[model samples]
Target: MKFVGPLIALMLAATPLRAEIDITEVTSPDGINAWLVEEQSIPFVALELRFKGGASLDLPGKRGATNLMVGLLEEGAGDLDARAFAEKAESLAASFDFDVGDDAVSISARFLTENKDEALALLRDAITQPRFDQAAIERVKAQIVSVIRSDAQDPDTIVGAEFDRMLFGDHPYGSAIEGSEDSVAALTQEDLVEAYKGALARDRVYVGAAGDISAEELAALLDKLLSDLPETGTPQPADIEVTTDAGVTVVPFDVPQSVAIFGHEGIARDDPDFFAAYVLNEILGGGGFEARLMEEVREKRGLTYGVYSYLVPKDQAALYLGRVSSANNRIAEAIEVIRDEWTKMAENGVTQDELDSAKTYLTGAYPLRFDGNGPIANILVGMQMDDLPIDYVNTRNAQVEAITLDDIKRVAARVLKPEALRFVVVGQPEGLES
Candidate 1:
């Protein structure tokens, strides 16, 4: 008998990881659109609900209310107090959570199939009829105010906040989604109520479900979740524009290290050259270890511990950002290096090897995004929120694979502008009088 037979057979029979995902477009009977995929391997289920207008639609003078409202959702609902809610969830071995971001708000739940109905009922109550108890409301508001107070003491936080204020000016996007100290201090229960009023609109909600449930059952659950929601006025999208005046804007803060955040606007998600733009960034700073910014700024000169650039995309506007940290004395040199790299990339684009490697990296990582039901459900919700094509999940890798060196050069030329750089330094630069 050959004792090694079982191990060899196992090795030979193993399946290689798949990079292509089959995401099916699904619609609820009540007219809500979603993307659903079934996985029964685990005896668990997950539901994620995303709404279009996130913190962006926070009513004027009530900044941070959206975040506060979501935080308070699980504190109490229906007849359960915060403690009672927690006890019930623990007993059922389920999880319910909510989060707010710049462009959307999400409520999610995970539960064993054995306790699915109880979890669903609890989640429905939280979304449709949150109690917003006054005591818990004050407690959360105080916590937010304290965090805002503490953030003000940080030099990086100071620089970033001031940078947004300068870049966005009077736009709603410029304001902190979590809000300022004054705003958070002034927030009350009425403000939370009003925020929920706008946020829970039926038209504003999009639901995604993945697990051991049929499309029909999910549709019925979605209706029940949103039925009590008022048909309140929809959130009006803002008209955001980015303007960068080329000069170093200095905001002096007392710190040993200088924090620099550089750059202006970048291409939006829907831009025709979005793929090319992504590749251009990968060569410049998006690639973690092999990026030009890291090789030149950190590796060669030892000017900073970390220096990288990225694109932050939004519904109507997007921004390009680069950060570097060095002693106050070497701050100007770091800034010059960043600017020179920008000019160099703009004039002469990436090499073919670099371009190929970037494409391969993006394509290889694409399939890892669908490793589990939670990630798959999140992707489905994102595509629906952005009104992306149903086939986007399947076709995205092909799109990346098809990009060429010429495409990289074209997009780099358009996006990388040293002259348009909006340089912001938040600490005192040595040898320069303020």
Candidate 2:
């Protein structure tokens, strides 16, 4: 009788569950916009800062300058040399990294709250007064060259290099963010310094913080971090054109397993049909297990261990890709099956069951992305970068659920074009249809 009373109270208390997120939008005294989310559940904090004019802003003949610039930021800052910098970070039990992407450069840090001062100081020094030391420059160049040389021998890397070269054409996005061996060898310390001077500006910066940070303190930290930055810089925008090139391009490799990457141009992040495209993608290939590509290419035919497809919605242009691997003999068959599925989905539209399952997966699995501060921080930053409304994470599943069969058909037709697809295979494949 007493057990029954306790169970009833437990059930009643659980009914009023709610989600709490203490989000504070802080504009630094110096005018940098930052988002601070204070989470007391964990004794950790993370800082993410982004600057505009990323790799796309690299000048002609300096295709990889932005990447090189950010690379040196952590190598030496103020008086700390590379080894000292690394040791200090290690001693503080902090994780710090910086990367340059198509449209921005980002620096992120994660550390325990006890070591907050050290981590923040390091980040501030790295951002404000990066040494760009000549010795460090040379060392980083050598490392980049080593990576370029090694990656040249990898089939997947070769395919990517070719794809980017073919897709973006003369644009900066077409080029590898990491410069070639020749480019890296030609890069001087001055190049990195100039890139840093031009790209890292206070007005173009945005910061996101989560896990144990108040709004006022976060803003003060950001002001110190970017105190040396200029007020503004030239905003470089990327204009990517969709190329219609459908043909088989083989990169000769002696590897036993062939890697196949096939795709065409896709919708950008701001497209109105973006949600529809996302849901259609899941039914077609993005669902992993119940996807058509997996069913046809893996489970049914046993052609490969894994096969999947999705639209990689990016800042400028999106890319739709279906990737799989199989023995050299099975590559052609896999591509054929993928193309056939594409054509069928476009022409006949997806079945009601496929549509229902995709909606269910997208809706039911939505809550998993909100489990932690880290994921929320990432999603928040991405939305900010893409110029999306702050309600994106909240309204995303409703958007997905609203997609009808006609919406799927319309998006599928626009998103998939077999004749425009560029076929890339890294090894010899059987059934040699192409």
Candidate 3:
């Protein structure tokens, strides 16, 4: 925690909450694209990079390759061993995070502006020349296997895994990114190398930077840092329409409570009605305590402590998903209430009051996202990935405010399908039948 205070001060002292954001799109000399938010007040910079087709790019029988590869990035790079890398980063007061998901590999970094060149060169080594030493591989592999063992015993993980199997069939989305313990233990140095190549190529990369940098400097930095990556890697997996098997699929475990994941297909991110669907989800289950599902399942009936639902629009597919937990004997009623609310929302939609409240809250909360340079950079990259216009920050609130009550009703009817709602319950619930 010794480093926490300075990082905090670096970000908050030049906060840009409720201020105009000027985004410039820059194309590096090597044809890499990046979004930049120049905040020169602080001698700090935050950089974010994403490579699409993340864990999904794993080769046949090589599940977890991308995940494992990402974990090894900072372990050793160029001539530095893991300890040397750690000491160097700390000496420079820099931080780096490497992560992967089903759709993308993400890297986030922050360093003092004065140390930009050194920090970037170090990062470039990690990105382009990871050693993946034999010892580090074994050590990280053991850690991942440990997590797989722990996840096996967790009800939340158990339920979600079963749900994905039912929902995605043979698609990569059906499998865990962590892979199985056997698959991970079998991974080789070559597999990690292939995984790294497939994941960090320029063709699928998106970059965003903020704080203490000029546009020309950022462009030059991008070229120097990323020019070594391959132009292309493995091809993305085929797109699959969601598999909706609408019924309760019970994975009975001896537990005191029942955890369930439910929902069906969802709208895409680029849909013209996406905002409407977002607003509708907030009204239905995505919002705080005032959301309809919470009002019905927790506030009124006391079936569970909390319930939440969100729209998942992935690069390959989309779905509306939610989770709830209750005492084994009571989860059935909770599901019943949730289903009822879903049907009601589809049929009747939201009232003007709900619409107005959601708009106000959604719009008001939007600005909080731009409070600091790190978040601003993250937002910029996400916007580029989502194919949003550069002026999106300025126009987003207006779009949310533009949604009408009729729009919500139409999107609700289109998105929520009660008959196709599948619930995967993991536990021993007395009165429930699959």
Better of 1 and 2 by TM-score: 1
Better of 1 and 3 by lDDT: 3
Tens digit per residue, CA lDDT, model 1, 330-410: 888888788889989999998998988888898888887765566667777877776778788779888988888888888
lDDT of 3: 0.91
Q: Is candidate 1 or candidate 2 better by lDDT?
A: 1
Judged by whole-model lDDT over C-alpha atoms, candidate 1 comes out at: 0.79
Candidate 2 lands at a TM-score of 0.90
Q: Which one wins by lDDT: 2 or 3?
A: 3
Output the number of the lDDT-best candidate: 3
Please, what are the lDDT tens digits per residue for candidate 2 over residues 220-265?
Answer: 8777778778777656766677685777778778988888788888
Winner by TM-score between candidate 3 and candidate 2: 3
- Residue 113 local lDDT, model 2: 76
Compute each candidate's TM-score over C-alphas.
0.92, 0.90, 0.98
Model 2 ranges with Cα > 4 A deviation = 1-22, 431-434
Best by TM-score: 3
Winner on TM-score between 1 and 3 is 3
Each model's lDDT comes to 0.79, 0.78, 0.91
